[model samples]
Target: MRSNLLPILTALGLLSLSQAFAPDPEPRWWKGNTHTHTLWSDGNALPEYAVTWYKDRGYHFLALTDHNILQESETWFPVATAGGARLQPDQVKAVLESKNPLLEERTREGQREVRLNRHTELVQRFSEPGKFLLVPGEEVTSSWRSPGPEGRGHPVHINAIGLEAFIPPARGTSVVDVLNQVFDAIAAQEKSQGSSVFGHLNHPNFGWGVSWEDMARIRAGIFFEVFNGHTGTADAGNENHPGTDEMWDRANILRLTELKLPLLRGISTDDTHHYHGGKVAGPGRGWIVVRAKSLDLDSLTQAMRAGDFYSSSGVDLQDLKVTPTSYSLQAKVREGEALTIEFVGARKGDAPEPVVFSTSQGAEASYTFQGDELFVRARVTSNLPHPAPKVEGETQRAWTQPVLPGR
Candidate 1:
């Protein structure tokens, strides 16, 4: 009924929201990092360091998602404990040596260090009109011990993007149990606050945690990390575990076929911790290009939930178009680099729906739906290697969002 009503509303020039699947006001792609960390958790740098790192590298937006913690209050952390007092020797050295303006030196309780700015304060300072933004978020690092040493268990991290409040990780014995609770908390927060929020399951292959079956059953888990930049978090699957790409296809197939759920959207992020060096799993390693009405947080999040974005690691999209049945895309190709655009999706009776529909060796590519397929999406691969490769032959790539039956 909702699908049938869209054409009527669009024709009558009434409110045509999702049925329209229309682009936002003056739509343009805004680049951002959705999963990230700072000194708030196990990250090695300050929150502002992460924020500025992305902004300087041409990102339009950012979400500082530290584990189970939001940057809400003023707190001082010891960087290099010495002289029996709190100290940030590395941060101080960097600040003084480089003379970065964002760094603030302060004396608190007879300890000298760089002052860590709260999320509220940094948002005010970093937000620029139509240029940069910081979307407040937190990573709910859930755990379910299933036989690891010291009771330390496999990790199930979910990032609640555009969150208005903090959500503690849901604890359970099964990964699916924890995932459902985390998603419910995100939903409940939006319900109570009268605001909007969207979240995605973090790297499935990280620590060899989360499987195709683990993600397939969670009706609320509509997004996951198809690509992550952190080297420790393996994106590719081995013989024993399903790689992120495999998990993505399998989960989508089971969800769309058996459960009749919504299509899962793919996202990428640096998951960066080290900020001082170029070789680290740092900012600019991965990002999402979101086509939205504006560069503000609200518009970006709205576009993201609607899958109006593509994940990329060092690949830039030149243009994209989608109808109910087909998708067209063009990638920005660098000189001396070869490009291959592959269309992938699931057909009837396939456990995983992704079968290659077309392969083009150029900057532009397109694919029309065969109509019998569950959904169709595209992946653009380039011969250009990453400036810092996570694994061997980890060339540059971009993932377009899936196009479903009516969208």
Candidate 2:
């Protein structure tokens, strides 16, 4: 028996050694938020409250992207109104109670509120090995105060994800010039820090600030929020600019088929500003489910860079795969609810044209990219009731992972 045991143990040891040397398998479905706000800016919740809200809600990661500021110094004032909205007294006190002791001491002379977490502290509390993570981020809130009558200042908010420090608002004379400055700043950050930071144009249709032509011209970053969860951001139905969904399709078609740039993908984010029960930007409205090998920042960012994720409003897809033979999608519906999947794509000759396809009402569907199609993208809509509707009395939508041609 001892002799037999010796051989078995030896075999087990060899197997373990080989397994250690083998490459890791791909990961599936890491839930996270790439956009969020805290008390540092206009958010009503404390940094700790926001972190705990996501962590408790089973999110694998989060990015505390306050507007134009990193969680550095303590900030406070009388709970006054800005943009015609005031913080609820109870909400303000709740945040003030959670302030860090050191922060309280530093601002003790005339402080009304204290910081809950610095940028480093937030990251530390939420980030965990292969389980939970947090990345440092900031929303560069820039707007062009147009001089004409009906002189609505065009609001352009861009999120700088995975940044090491705060980037002050880079205002410009024009909207185009502002975006250029942003891209230039991101480029500089990349060169200096050796970090994997990416920028995305947020809420392009918010006040009709960014146009499709603008998106076509700026080729620096390959990401934008096609779906934002704030009020009046205009995710759908515009005269000149297409809906966010349509904008995504058009942008990809133009980039790949027309300009021959890399296929730019869309991200869905809860650009949450109101945290404590109000009718503004709230959580769980729209989110991205990334498929990566781990929850680490590098793995998550790499998967996003490779476009290995699907944006969702309310629908959930069981599986989304883009293969050599075909593009496939499988969705799970809410109990007793029906589901439909669509396979949309375009060909090389079909430049500047849209690809639209839909499946029969069922749980699964597939589309074959036969012959020379320039690209393929897909979307799924479910009969299940969405918690938040895009418009009144509208059904929910889930976008599939895009399948690029000849990749």
Candidate 3:
């Protein structure tokens, strides 16, 4: 009877087809961090404490991408008065304060051990519908050593976001080979899961490990970290190496013009390790704001792959609109803060270096497409100093995804 009434209402034009079924919710910007660690791996803090930190700071989602491990197994940590069990005093304090019932107190031969909560438990404790989310992920950490007297090696770390199972690091002869292997594995997982899973290359310049040319040669990965908050990585390259931004531009130029692969999108991540003190690799340093219908895993990952996100160290974008004919941006700024928006891109000719097409002052800027450009992207810089600057003399900055001429 209800089905017949719906058809009769449609026939009488009381309800249009568009109105008969609910449309998707309007997409909104959700703040999230893709790479962070806890005691599930080498990080100093407990899993619940990390979630509490981000949630309290208004982060919509957090991915705990521990090194080659998922938070699915049972684990325990020693309650240390001194620094023992690879646990610091502050870490123990944070864990005990949470009062998680899963924590088992046992006298293990001499030391007191407390069972740690698994990822499932963490999800049940913190995740709220459309408010905060915990995404399960893994850092497929791998390395390769060059065959020489010095035996120098490179760290190849790739992050797999929104995965249900663990994936071991894929190996190969060279850096490019290893990267391609990891991307292939990620693809296989996506195919098998029938869900959108996100993957990105992490910190290309950490060990001066991946060169711009190496990045351009990869067959698959479409995302990489343009800015990582960790101080260990050389984000600003020296005389011999190029920075991550340089690598991004050069690799995109090669990929779009010559290699015939898709342009790479940039991401900013905290890569957090320490949660206490003025530690270098701490949280709240970098993140991405994704525009999606809701703050769920599927929506966030879908929006990210669609290039509907912006990465930031400190600058927050007020508005970003990209159409087939133009690119525009406006930043949300505080008083006494100055803004500079650089419209950067390359031309359609042979091996053109990325040049600033135009620059705008104040809080807003834009550029109309000339139809002769390979791609265009924006960079917003502000005078406000980063609370925890990744590099010396660094200020606040944000990067938008590159826009192709059309499609």
Best by TM-score: 3
Q: Count the backbone clashes (under 3 Å) in each candidate.
A: 4, 1, 0
- Candidate lDDT scores, in order, read 0.81, 0.75, 0.86
Report residue 77 deviation for candidate 3 (angstroms): 1.5
lDDT (tens digit, per residue) of candidate 1 on 133-166 = 8888899998878755565477899999888888
What value does the lDDT take at residue 97 in candidate 3? Answer: 70
Per lDDT, the best of the predicted structures is 3
TM-score of model 1 vs. true structure: 0.87
Candidate 3: tens digits of C-alpha lDDT, residues 1-407: 26568788989999986777777888899999999998888886777778888988999999999999998887777767664445665655665677553455677889777676788988898889999998888999989777779878889899999877788987789999988898888888888998767789999998988888888877756999999988888887889998898789999999988889988999999998888855579999899999999988888878787789999999999889998888998899898999999988788886689778889888998899998889899999899988777567789899999889776
The per-residue C-alpha lDDT of model 3 at residue 110 equals 90
Q: Write the per-residue lDDT of candidate 2 for residues 1-407, one digit (tens) a residue.
A: 24455556557784454454457876889988888987778876667777777887988888889998887775553443344443444655564465342233133445344445787776665677877888888999988877778677888788988888677777787787787788668767866888678888898899898876667555677788878888678888566668877777677777776677777678888888777676678887888899998877778778998878888888778887777778878887778777777777565673456667545678788887776666677777777666666676656777865666546
List candidate 2 stretches off by more than 4 Å. 1-25, 76-112, 145-152
